[model samples]
Target: MDKELKQLDNTFRKLPQYPTKVIQFGEGNFLRAFIDWQIQQMNKQGLFQGGVAVVQPIDRGMTKVLDEQDDLYTTLLEGKLNGQKVQDHEIIESINETIRPYEDYQSYLDLAKNDDIQFIFSNTTEAGIAFDENDNLTDQPQNSYPGKLTALLYERFKLGKKGFQIIPCELINHNGNTLKEIVLKYAQLWDLGQDFVDWINQENDFYATLVDRIVPGYPKERAADLEKEWNYHDRLIVKAEPFLIFVIEGDKKLEKLLPLKEAGLNVVVTDDMQPYRNRKVSLLNGPHTTMSPIARLAGIDTVGQVMKDPDFYKFINDEMYQEIIPTVALPEQELNDYAEGVKERFENPYVNHELSSIALNSISKFQARLLPTFKRYFAKEKKLPLRITLALASYLKIYAGKADFAPEDTPEVLAEFKELRQKDNYVQATLADEKLWGEDLTQFPGLIDLVKQDLQIIDQQGSRKAVQMINEKED
Candidate 1:
């Protein structure tokens, strides 16, 4: 085994040397496959001369593996485009170095002071932002990523350096705003003075970004085949779908600086990301959240299988297009197109997208993703959206720890449901929990009773009967 600097594929030999101008906060497969892949395209087109310094946001990560490979890895993109099968592999060379925050804190902090590092990117997951009151300003590295970021920013400010443009790729809505708020809180907590706060408010730019791509990370199951395909063993090989969308909400100045359009990527920089956000949450994510538990309980395993099944497919297309899309504010044609794209994404043959995996945080998911449509539909029609409502009930029933037709359900949703079930009243137990729904869902007229009734029906008659009952009922 030749364990040395080698390009397993000839793809890396022609890449140009780019300046290290971006500080990325995650070494996960999604960032490598999605963002790095785009950066590679930019480099190839001579649109960007910037490289990325990858930093592991957590303790245990692939920093060592990336370092061993000299920050080189393969990205396997698999999916369909325009009804044609597509699968392509490319080697990414935009990553110049990798660093771990735990092992070398000063090195991570030093990146902040580097004038060349102009862009800050992060995908620290949904729960990344938090107020850690105990984090000290003088600590080698603050416990939270945001705290560490604040320290770095303060250091940069003290050194009379302009603030870097930050774009957090966290899954939460308005992630960059939330991160900026927390960073400001840390600044106030540590008594860093108003001067630093003013500098942060003026010099820094935090743009909220909505990123969409299905990166399944490492393909351990196909490692042997992948090794043969590339003629070398790669520990950091990432697999992702062909579809990618990056919606960045920022001013025109920042948009000019990014120049993502010049690279021919699906990147949108706009003053209002609300339309794109609505398109994603209502069209794609809402149906996903609605369909997952129902499909799982109906003996379907993966999203592709569900789309292929006549009953489930009709439910998605008809129920989603006819019922759900009507409730949204977008034009009918745009909604229909988005719905069709959603269906295609669901039916993507290369992805195994298990319904059970999407069942996590179903309660919050409903509140944030689907509840608005439900409310709007109810308000306009003066009746419940039966299929969407039924999906909600199915989610509650799924949460009640029923034996799913698929593999054993993860305990995340089941644990919360069990705790809610222990309460004296089911409606009070679940709907009144503001922490889950972000507000009292009980306030909605007839929602609590409807959910309770449908959940009871699901418990007694099973998923199929419950769905049939909803579908057959005359409102």
Candidate 2:
């Protein structure tokens, strides 16, 4: 710790001047390490010639820190690559300026007049694209991300300028379309009229994008070691996984604007990103949701520990290949390859991904990540999926206060779980709750029985023994 004190006053490098062609919302770690780094890579390849002007979506954000350092930051990428451990680092120089809209509303509105700007990239989180009727067109700064964006678009429209290619990186199912819908709703609410609405609908193009990258953000434990290695002090330092893919549902025209693919980056501009989205949600997130509870109940903490455990590992691998893969519409080889990557990511040596972290809001996660595949399996086989139902049972067990870590969820959900814990037929009651799983899961052929059976095994044999038994029984 004393050795780290040697460079406490060291300065970070500054970015080069480039025309701000992109307006970025949310200057968080993921954006800096993924999108900004991609732009820097494109810039380095000379395939793209532009920089980003980050807009502060919320009143309180990292814009002050970003402005202090001339919007410069270092990104560190670490993970396994083809059975070999590797690390990559870059001083991301894609951000030319930062804007705090709350501080200077006029300056924020003036960004629309910048003719060089052609693209707007946003990752204002999943709930950021919501409609708030409280916001007005004449407000200094609007309440929601959609509201702020609407104000900007109206400004650009009144100036008679062409609209931007707005790409939304939110994790919602249809992020771009959702954002557009909310923006249009705001237009209607504020009485912005037909011509302004027409300008928004016709001139601008909103894209649904799936950005996959695990940015753990600011390696606090090893910051001193990193600072010692880099010989600089960067308060905005971000650590990211080596693997990332940006799947964008947009036109061929967007491909020409930002040549991220041309630079050999993992940017896929496709007519349909649903296949990729499904592949990711199922193969990647499904395993995460499934493994967390079972492993946590079995006294496991991190995902790396889960991978090391023979039973938990087998459960994940079997669940993905046997139950989850067939449900996704992607090609066989693609699914298998992605499954391999997900397993690798689960065992990333550098990250300690806590099962407790993934265990938050287990109900919603199970509904979104695993239920579709579970339903599909039921449709195809007319039988319950052994591995998936076990996962569901594991979720119920943990929520029933069978684990060391306290389960996290909405208060309403927690209260319901508390009530369900008192029921005699707990699994049946839980499955019949349509508000929990979106539909009565008990209606599925033999689902309730399967869950009850798994719950019995978990109760008697313990989570570890249950996992081992399930895999061994299948084999």
Candidate 3:
């Protein structure tokens, strides 16, 4: 057991208390920097009088460390806002306590019975909301996130408690709907009956949400320096960018309850969040996915580094504005505005976002984020999206291993790339593989020939010089 640190209220004069009104699953960096921080902002304004009880979603988490700090931690926000550096640090006081449900089942159930807890928030990673057939309701805590939530809801139902507005911030599409579906599946599987299902439907509000923030979690490299600067030692310190937006697709009335926008937070409650999702995934995530490989191959280690290089910056800018922005279905001005913000975020000095980290699971990320833009740009303009073609070719080299950063993909993908190292016309074979891609990718107009051309340029000029070609070429 670790010795608990003395309460921080003395160091930072703070609120005495707030009634626990939120039950947040997953005490990870993203939730702490985004959701809990937002709650603290609201509490600061006296717009909200509620606190959060964090449930450790996974067994091995930072709940113990959180407890040591008396559920208090500092969130450091740093990035460019309106062309100037913005930095702020706040000791978040929204968290009332931390609970590990796996350790105590009855205590978890008792938390569910709290009438003041009106909102349920989670960011249990993409794979958290799954159905584990092995999960039994009688188990102390079920195997999957949905199963655990089902038990919590069931406990509340039995006590005649009001349902929570469940908002899931998983990166997966339709997060809340997926979680709600799995909960229903659990209800049927456990023979919890139609009453439970009906209660979940009628009483609970399941929201599909889109969350955007650049939270790089703990500052491992700079932690000592930060602690020295702040005159405090915090194991759970979270580093975040200045920009944040949470878009929830539900009735507008729900906004009144959270009162986030009123707190000067960037929160939107719209009837349809699909457009917002598309905007974020395309303008922000798409660039990261496509640029990481190319930039890393060009000997740039971080997104910020790429932004500093004029040649490479122009290359990426041309691709985003000329190729991607032209194809998005949203308004041109909106896309431009978001793209500007993305550039600022990439140039954030405090956050050294490694290209290697962004390069994780590259195959799936490319398909979801960049493929649609590639397809639309080609189909709409009747010309090959040249930058995208180059990015596609650079991807092969990225997966080949031996870059400064290690490559991590499925075993099968790594093995195939190893085999492709020996095979002739490997690009054709790679794009033709229906299994690797969802379909035969070579059929797209000018895709095969143009990608081959880019591969040759990459080989001759090298990645750094090849990127310089984008600035000179009219195309």
Candidate 4:
């Protein structure tokens, strides 16, 4: 067996450190596998001469372990690349060092002073950008991500330095705009004066970015076998799918700052990322959420298997092409191309995306990913979309214990399900639960009856048989 690997030990050649040109906020698997890996590729091509300094946004994080390994880690890229199974692995040497902001606040602010630092990237989770009024400006490192950012921006504004191009890759919609609003709120709450606000508004450019990549991260189950093959005992060996798409809503001139397009990366630096965002959320995410419960009930496990199965495949495509695409606002050809790409991504040979994993908090996921499309499809067609409604029925069935599918929801949600199961008018009652769907879904005419009918069919037949019936009815 190979020895445990650390940085710059004679086992591997030492890499020359470039100037820290990007200050990143999250050192987690997603950023490391996606963003840092992209930077490593650009640096290898000699197109980008920079390094990333990852800061641990929260106190309890992986910075200590990262620092122990000298910030070096391996990324295993495995998935179908252009219809061929490919597995590529490389040691990512892009991170210069990691910093814990809570311990060394001044050092964190000092990053803003670096002349070469032109970009700031972050993926601090969806809830990370929230405004925390309890966080004061004087508190070391501040409490929230935006609070720390506002403090750092005020420091840089005081020094009269050039502003950094900020792009937050948080999963929320319009993440950069939301973060900017919170930072402005913090500036006002902290009484940092109007000049700092102006500097923040005029100097820095915060771009809303949508990042897509499936980083399963740190294959614990296969680590020993993988370590034996690679002849290295790297702890941070992350696993990611081959598919990646980054859509950034930014000033076109700023593309020069992040010139990874030459490296053949699928980076769309567009002014309107909403359409791209819609395409991904609707076409990619919508189908995934809609298919999870139904697929699980059908005894299917992975997404690739769902695509390969004839009946499940037809059910997914019918939902996409008939209902989902009509709700999206994009060019016909463009949307069609994007849908095809999403299908390819779903069929990635190497990735085994479990339906149960996707089924976590599925009620909430349906509201965010599929509900808008469901409403829009009804509005345009003036009729309920059958497959989406059936998917809803499948979701309810899974939660109600009618199907053998296990669900992961809040106790409150499970309680509601239990109450609904006990009710005589369970279908109508559950459909009218405003707390679950934000608004009563029953307000849409024909929705209640259609869902009730689908539920009856699903109850009588199996999910796979119901899928066949859906396809036949669609045909």
Candidate 5:
């Protein structure tokens, strides 16, 4: 049977009444299930009359599926919340329409001139913001999402329209602010004039947001059960955890703009989202970055498996609680609670987060996620952290692209590592790369020798032995 063409379940077919006031820049599952789902709730409660006009950020996305279903899709929220097993299902109907920017560039540009549009939401990922100097104002849809946004903002300014409140849900820190900065840089590069720049600076409300959700998106693995349960096949069915948090650093007026709190959501409007950001980065991202290479090399495939491994779990707790948490500036009890929550998130049995997937751009990740702890600890104790330094060494070795002691995984650190590996000076080549390490790692007392020694250990005895060696090493 062609189940996707069948009618949706009775509970999900009914559409909610709301006005289209938001132009979302990404139509992926995360935005659909998380953002749109919340909007659906708001519409149902009569707290919000706004709907989302989803814009396909890139050339390719779920626009076809969305268009096929009249911008309607089902989301399955399943997980433990507050010591209770919760499973809920709903079809999101807050998406008024979906547009492909490449095909209907004029239509997308025309959206900016709409006085009804007041909020812009996006989750274009970490690399979405960049200074693409070649992106002229006339391009159909600029190569980067931020570039397209710059053009849109300029159009809005030209029309003498009020600035829209922007809330970017990218995983990067200061995401909205960074995106605004890049857009301004593009405006300057194109010489869009001071008026437009001033409009962006003074009028536009760029609120940095911290979003938390374990949206796995599309349950391809559990298709049979899902199809049976829903009584229809949905290619775009998104699965997510029950927990969701959206912290926006903006004016309290946003409470009136987005009444998500009234609709029973964990949305927070604050003057600063720094504490929440720090908690997420230090507790969640920090452990993930440190554990990925170590776990992957330990023969564990998923984060669930790594959490199950006693050694890896202990390493995370010891490094995060005993070592990393102490260095962070937040209160001790709050940091401990965050660390506990992070451990639970890592141990999420439903998600099969691949360690190898997390290993991409690991060098840069270490600097962003883990280096703060490294710096803080060194300054406080005047000694290097052994486990973290070992993790760094493991990362460098993993980038050597080896699986069974010989080169196997594709190296994605940079071209220099590959070039240096060819010259039989892997350690020297890596340590000397000022761009990779920021400064020479050799300058950090015995860091180079320690890293080199750990690399050799990993090469000889494998990841498990290397971790054991570090665990046993006296500080």
Candidate 6:
């Protein structure tokens, strides 16, 4: 007989329910594995005495299975840290219940009446904080996440409930601030009145946050075997890396309330999170953005594969230390350690990270993650960075509608690239495109020509040949 995992089961039956002090906006695997996992630790240590009440922000979500299992799930933490294999498991009981506002609008609003709920967390995705002008206050459930939040806050204001500390975990820059802006915009658009607006501005606190963790959700292929061994069938078993960091920018109140740091959790409650944010974005994300399209064009499929190849591996290292790191202003040793961590993450055997998966929306990602470094390097060095330029060239070629590798970009971006491919002086024209890179890249004198030269080599000899040529040049 197969044993099904249940909260009411003997093994998990004794777990106590803490009051719901956190209302999380998304119940995705990331929150379960990263944030809630940390919460479970804090709970076990008796440092935090609260549970998360998850709200499904979208019309469809995983609440059904969550509710079916009585909100019980396992998180398998696996990865390498400092040359040691770290593996562990935890049954996360930090989630008390899930509310899907699309189904139960009244219950969702009624949550605002709960005096104990003091924290609001959300991970609605990159586009979740957008301002939707059409979403009205009267809708049973407002269309956008920000709109829905506005309604909830208004309800809380009307009920004279205490304001909550809002921390949004979206990947966008200044996520909490952005969400607050949109919520306030909705308030004005719907004319929720000046007093409600004052309540929002004065009573509530919105903080910028940064979250890092690689959660490869639902180990479906290996789950049956794991289930057989553990003697419990777990449908929502999430697989994630051991490395987790949550940085929040707030005042002393946050520092005092969040005692996760006291429990040795990787939570940073700081007044200035910009340095930490810069360290992560430049060291970790920059190399990732540069390598993906270039590796894919050179016929490498996964990040692990890219890290294994002698040529590709060297290119990534060279790009990080030579091109990218020079542009960052953080302490050298700190940057080096971060770079090493990036290498470890890339080489993690447990993660089957496809380069193509990272290649999605490559244009936007490169602009955000790599372009600043490229610009900074050029301005400081007074010369072009070869490896990054080559990578940029690879980006253009992959999108030129001629390469064997298919890049995933918006239709408009793809069409623009197709048009650029057909034009005379295509390299010069494309490099000068301000709409794409947010600046005229051609302003850097020799940068355009170097990219043009690389693109020429890639076109004639293929991407692999181009990579070999660059390797030879470096040598």
Instruction: Tell me, by TM-score, which candidate is best.
Output: 5
Quote the lDDT for 416 in model 2: 91
lDDT tens digits, residue span 1-475, model 2: 4444433221443434679999999999879988899998888877788999999998889988977666887888889766777697777888888899889999999999999999999987644666778899888899889999999999999999999999998776788998999999998998999999999999999999888887767777787778778776668788878888999997878888889889988889999999889988888888888888888778887788988888788888999989988777778998999898888898898866667766767787788788888999888877888888888998888888876668887656799999999999888999999878879988987888878877888888788888888888753
**Where does model 2 exceed 4 Å of error?**
1-11, 56-70, 82-85, 99-110, 130-143, 297-299, 354-365, 390-469
State candidate 4's TM-score: 0.80
**C-alpha lDDT values of all predictions:** 0.78, 0.84, 0.83, 0.84, 0.79, 0.82
Off by over 4 Å in 4: 1-14, 58-61, 82-85, 101-110, 125-129, 132-144, 158-160, 296-300, 331-334, 356-368, 389-442, 446-472
Residue pair clashes in candidate 6: none
Stretch of 10 with least lDDT, candidate 5 = 404-413
Off by over 4 Å in 1: 1-17, 82-84, 130-144, 219-223, 356-364, 394-422, 473-475
TM-score of 2: 0.82
Cα lDDT tens digits, model 6, 98-142, are 998999999999999999898999987654677777899899898
Candidate 3 Cα outliers beyond 4 Å, as residue runs:
1-13, 82-85, 101-110, 127-143, 189-191, 360-364, 382-386, 389-404, 407-474
Cα RMSD, each candidate = 3.8, 4.0, 4.3, 4.4, 3.4, 3.9
lDDT of 6: 0.82
Model 4, position 340: C-alpha lDDT score: 91
Model 1 per-residue lDDT at 328:
74
Error of 2 at 450 (Å): 5.6
* TM-scores vs. true structure, each candidate: 0.85, 0.82, 0.82, 0.80, 0.88, 0.84
Residue-wise lDDT of candidate 5 within 1-475, one digit each (tens)?
4545464533455655467899999988778877889988888888888888889987878898777776777888877788687787877788888878899898898897778888999987654655666788889989888899999999899999899999998777788888999998998888999999999989989999888886767777786677777677566788878888999998899898889998899999998898888778777878887888887777787777878987777777788876688888889998888788777877877766666656656676676678777878888888888778888888777667665433222233456677767767677668777767667766678787888888888888877887776666565
Candidate 1 local accuracy as lDDT?
A: 0.78
TM-score-better candidate, 1 vs 4: 1
Q: How many angstroms is residue 104 displaced in model 4 relative to the true structure, after the best TM-score fit?
A: 5.8
